[model samples]
Target: MSGLSAALLELRRTLDQEMFPLKVGDTASDRHALKELAGQLDDYLLPRLAALDAPLLAVVGGSTGAGKSTLVNSLVGAEVTEAGVLRPTTLAPTLVVHPADAGWFSGTRVLPGLPRSTGGGRAEAGTLRLVTAETVPSGLALLDAPDIDSVVKANRDLAAQLLAAADLWLFCTTAARYADDVPWGFLRRARDRSTALAVILQRVPAEASGPVGRDLRRLLEENGLGPVPLFEIPELRLPENGALLPETAAGPVRRWLEELSADARTRAAVVHRTLAGSIDSLDARVRGLADSVERQRLGARELADLAESAYTAGLTAFDDGMRDGSLLRSEVLARWQDFVGTGDLMRGLESRVGRLRDRVVAAFTGRPLAERELTAAMANGVEALIGAVADGAAERTVDAWLATPAGRALLEDEDVAQAGRLGRASPRLQAGAERAVREWQGFVLDLVRREGASRRGAARAASFGVNGLGLLLMVGVFASTGGLSGLEIGIAGGTGVVGQKLLEAVFGDQAVRRLTGEARSDLAERVRVLLAQDRGRFTVLLSPTLEADPGRLRAVAGTIRAHRGELSGGGAK
Candidate 1:
């Protein structure tokens, strides 16, 4: 009994070191493998400890024809069990339990996968029997488990499970089945778990005894099987084709069983040995499954990086669209040559209203050229400039993006369709230009017409002085710069410099020189206002975002500075 107690304590110690913190149930595939191993240990071991008030059990487990029933009958000193039965000797496990305890038998029927129980003598059909025996040792029980490698599938599974719950296992195998793969596979499983195991080499054939013993030892050593206590029972004499093992050598088998199950010390040792080893085995299986679970956790980081990559792609598409709108500058530029050219443009403009002050002084100057002629010329000139600029910029913009790898990659390599912003067909800019042209043109004309109507209010007023301040008085009519004809105004700012040319075309430069240079300064001032009013709206929209990252935004700022240079250049840069 002391040996049994010590063995059981040792088993508990082993379990604490290896599988104390077992977690079980409610996990998916890879995790479920670990969970199941832990569950088996808990289910088997926890119940045993809780039933400590019940007698200790030694579960005899082994493969078919290993003489397990023969060994059991020998230990009990009676022909109490059938052997070599075609129906299988132990269809259900028979328990030799303490007689007075009806507690273990009361609700045993509800237990899962276990067979039915009837009385204290025999377990019912489809169940293991619990029998009471007085000489069965105080606080001790023994189970004759089904053959682990039985032909019946359920029996095989039941045997393996019973092995897990066992406090002590009598591992019986004949010399013939000793090295069999299926039995050894279970042996290995038990070995890793440190299950308390005592091997029985039963019924050795006389001819192959010596060689087989050596081979078995060698195989056991290679597999890390412990120096488990071994009990060898020689083949006993029997009638040919007999139904039972002919009895002999019952003494040795009984002594070992008593050592394992009878006295308190030996029983405790058996208990300790079995449980400690089983915990170690359980830990290993669970740990292996845990490693697989960890590999899956690492995949989440990859998913996050993929999201950031998508954002970068979107920003790139937006940048390309901005560049596309820049091409409309080419539309504006197309008018550049024509607006800057030598023509009757200045002469014609001066002839219409160049002498407005003098004409007003002469009574009919208040009525200038009709709105239709002025409107027609301005529209034709702006269209020509826009068409020419749009054509030149279309191809160049694509090439510019292709000039460097970054820009080329932005234009040609990406999923541009996903970005959906257009570089070529940007209506914002065309709209901005077309819109600016219509807005400011109408504004200027309305100013001229209103002033014309005001003067007509006084039909007899002597002179219409072309006041340089007239441009300022015109601003009250419109809401935003989008209403301005900024494109034409931008092209004509250069033409504004040729005041001498304007005077010559209208009144002959010779005649103008005869008057004061002070008069020419007055003319220049009006032209300056015309130039400013034309460009005021477009300039306001071109500023940069203050919140953007400095290094990235620097390029946008650089583009703006270069376009500003466009205003400063004599058209070369």
Candidate 2:
């Protein structure tokens, strides 16, 4: 018994660890079932197993106005439970126990989730009101549950909970209401659970009782409930007090209860049958819930995959834009032309090699317009490229996500959709990109100063060398490769070579190549870092729907299978 209890406890613990929010489609039913299963385990199964000798509780439940409360009152031979013509006569559940069995229910031994109270006091409507009747047998108790199809939502829910906690269900319904769809639904569930149940066909006309009883039996047999007991209470004149006609009118049901309560072994068999059946049903129900969790995980992964593919395309597009010489056009082209005069400086550098510094300083000092414009054009080109890539990536990610079910759910929240627009870098991204560029430019300036350190006192190297050489290094980094025979290569490479020679005249060939290589590598690294940071915007948006680990669900299934014998009664506990 302890081992079975521990296994059931472990199952409840495993279920509690799951979060089955209805964010995923097709999950609401599974979520509701999961909650109900957990409640049954806590309120009934484990508690009942711990105290197998506890009194048997037979909950009388059925469709609205099906004479459930009336049947309960007559079974105990007293008005222990309220019965009247009000729409929902019993708003709260009333448990009718014998005087000797009062202590069993008053404590937190069963249905502990509901607070226990005595009758005729100011108890909340949700409380379980206990009523002791001497006519009721000591070894058994009867609970008058709310109408299964009550108009009030709370009453309807409470009815299902009470039924799930019952050792046996004395399902009561009228001749007129037995064939109703609602009552049959509960009957079908009871059949599936293999619960101990007996139908009480109440308020039947004497002339129609034979036909109605046969028809009800056929329906029960067809629905996998062939051998379940069926007793009839025909229409008869009630006493002035509105109680049942007499003990003879309630003959069969009263006799069954008396026999069930009198025989201790019979009562234990009923409890064992219901308890074992409920435990056996857990594997399928728990598997259903675990499958629902897996579906949620799959939905999340689908959304994440969409985001990943879209952003990866964006990254590819950005890399292509940088390598295809697209940034060398428009204002940037005009600035480079103005700075070096269509490659004239490279053509004359070898002829005027000795006087290079004097001419370079004079040209730079007299007109710094080309140099300033070139630096501005480079910054503008890089910024525009980055912004366009960011926007394209954001748009693609949003579109892909919108096409999916999970994505549509997320987009329903206007704020999440608004946050997904990545057309421009955020303030933080823009600041970081700009700072990286500025730092790379500083690295170039340092290289120039270091190369010119041999000629420390030279005025040209100190004044314009750092700024002029750094701008040339920026232009060189924009050139794709030195092997192209096209006009773009000449225009871009010509500007780069002019910078190379001027620096070589001041330093030497080896230092010039090494310095430019180092500076260009530094700039490339900075741009890559900035773009990677911008990619994080898409990742952040997709984080909520990421797939969770499925190992916990597998572990739960494994544990249930390991203890199947004890739970299913193949071996005694």
Writing each residue's lDDT as its tens digit, candidate 1 over 217-282 gives 787788777586676777776563323443355566566665655566666656555555554453
Q: What TM value does model 2 have?
A: 0.76
What stretches of model 1 exceed 4 Å from their correct place?
1-39, 51-54, 78-82, 85-90, 100-116, 119-126, 237-247, 295-573
lDDT of 2 by residue, 1-573 (tens): 556677778777766754453267666687788779988998788888888889998999998887887788777777777777878878889998999999999988889889888967434689999989998988999999999999999998899999999999999889988899988898888877778999988889989989999999999999999899998888876765447646776777988988998999899889888887887777778777767777777776676667667656666765566656667766776787666544454454445434433454455554578788888888777777766676676677667766776666666666665544453455576677667766777788887777777664346566665778677556655655433445556555554555566666666677767876787667666766676676577556555434333466566656756775664453434
Which 10-residue window in model 2 sums to the lowest lDDT? 541-550
TM-scores, one per candidate: 0.44, 0.76
Alpha carbon deviation, residue 387, candidate 2 (Å): 4.3
Q: Each candidate's lDDT (Cα)?
A: 0.47, 0.74
The deviation in Å at residue 300 for candidate 1 is 9.4
